[model samples]
Target: MASQVPPQIFSRRRRIAGLRRARVRQAKRDAARYILDDMVEDVLDRLEFIRMSPTRVLVIGDWTGTLALSLRGGGSDVTEHDVATLDEEHPVESESYDLIVSLCSLDRVNDLPGALLHLRNALAEGGMMIASFLGAGSLVNLRRAMLAAEPDRPAARMHPLVDNQAASALMQRALFKRQVVDSRTLTASFGSLDRLVSDLRDQGLGSALANPPPALDKAAKARAGAAFLDTASDQGRVLEIFEILTLTGWKN
Candidate 1:
């Protein structure tokens, strides 16, 4: 079947270079980049819990390439694929990989179910798939700010998030045995909204909607900043919530 997702949504042209630049900028600055690193660490921690020692592994959407590095460090054979190299219809040989880990990438796919099915097909029996992405309820504060900015007529400033329930069902639809879906909320406090946005850009978390809304006017931007500040806590910093959803399943 043809993919329902439009190829332009991800705009893979120079995507790898863009990700590399983002990580470089992140390292040069002391700003909070722990979200991406944290997500990778969390995936590793989960692997440790399962006591997984797979000889063949695949790391998808690893823009920073850290996950592949870590897996190779542990003496596992790892192949890295990112948005630049993968599409919904990418072919996979059955029972190819004993383990697959995807970080911060699946949510942007146009054909999520098809992608899941492909991943399931690529896994060996009892091989595990661990994927994480921003889910619904993420960027609540930012959404609110964007809404307040365009009070007259709201525009699409961000991509829609995948709900956890729907994600779990997708696992079943993909025929992943022992499927599980879970979420966690990570709150990031920023002194200003611009800093928050900068942090997002530094992590390659910018909007990837097919038809992104027009850039906000200067006045609207100011309004958003004010709205964000209005919600600041006693510590004088605004809080933004990032709902990280983790999907786990095994091919049995």
Candidate 2:
């Protein structure tokens, strides 16, 4: 049996729809390409030093299909699953895969521990699992803008992120061997507040909170825009920081 997803944390439908839309836009736009590309590249580059090349691979959250294609191109047999299709109890045979990779989706999972356990169960002995997602300290400027819009009483809008330490703990709890968690920050610049929000949407960074804050009314939206603009650099561009956490482990 799988653990129950906590309703207080995320909305599955919204998260799914956001990724689906992102998949579509990614074919035509470059705005959201770097993050996913960078993650896959990092994993592959590290695999070189480890002296391992997984032959049977499972890739989750290949919304733009880049990661899966990259693996297949490198001669690995690949199985792909969009993250939205995976539930807490999604079946995977024990010792089924030599490698598993998930990018940018685990953060939105309502039953993260359960998901990690399943991934571990699917890995063959000595097999590796590597996953990455948005982490704590991300989006400082955007968070500030939202709060400024409703200074008196801010609502729950952004999804909370798991920091590096917590991520390591989760891997240990899931019984993955050689657990490791680390983070890196990537900075994205935008010409305007609205453009920043649009880029987020394009990248499937929509709110996954189960009870999302009410839509910003015109007045509030205007205020947020004004506040966001005030923080622009001398070049008249706003920068948003994305802290990406990576978790890695091997099945014993």
Candidate 3:
């Protein structure tokens, strides 16, 4: 006789789904410090072209708040919002900003194009938006490992990744003028798979596997652990990839 579907599987599925939603939400609020701090600082350093004395500025996402804090410290008027809070019915006031900065948060948005348009609408003519986010190429190794572990599993509901070309194309379609887009992959290493997974949780990257495979029994967990261990290098290190896309454009 065929074995019954394990109750644990359903439980795991529900847990994973909840985790995914939580992570997506967390990504908006918690703002990973190491990533946000570095990326925001870099964007600020490159803001020489943008007028320094803008009377009103909008910062979207937490990293944007970090940028706003810096700009305010330098004496710029700054207000902030979480992108998730913005929508058609409750739009940001029209033409309210001289500058808008969004950092490392757009990819989690359900409507990237719409958000760009809203950002454009919120800006005064000649205002600029500088945004950075993790694109399609992020997290290749973890994705591969997950697939390797469960080749028959169903596809993910949320986007687990984004690529550079796709991100650039989306920005182009948004009609921002003379858009500047650049992307680069940053690799972080972990001493073991467990630590790697832990770091992902800490960074709010665990949300992608919204419906991870059901919890394996002790034997299965051991087997998967062995498989990963076998694939590890002599130093027992595993690599996680973060592909960051940076873009700047003006609302003409």
The global C-alpha lDDT for each of the candidates, from Candidate 1 onward, is 0.82, 0.82, 0.62
TM-score of 1: 0.91
Q: Across residues 154-199, which tens digit of lDDT does each residue of candidate 3 receive?
A: 3442354456667667677877887888877778776655666555
69-127: candidate 1 lDDT, tens digit per residue: 88888899998877766664465654679998888888877678888889888998889
lDDT by residue for model 2 over 100-190, one digit each (tens)?
9988888887778878998899998889999988899888888888998898999977788899888998999999999899888899888
lDDT of 3: 0.62
TM-score of each: 0.91, 0.92, 0.74
List candidate 1 stretches off by more than 4 Å. Answer: 1-21, 93-95
What lDDT is reached at residue 144 by model 3?
A: 57
Q: Which regions of candidate 3 fall more than 4 Å away from where they truly are?
A: 1-32, 49-53, 63-65, 87-90, 157-160, 208-231
> Over all chains combined, what TM-score does candidate 3 have?
0.74
Candidate 2 wrongly placed segments (more than 4 Å): 1-7, 88-94
Per-candidate total of colliding backbone pairs? 0, 0, 4
Pairs in clash, predicted candidate 3: 135-162, 136-162, 136-163, 137-162
**Alpha-carbon deviation at 235 in model 1, angstroms:** 2.7
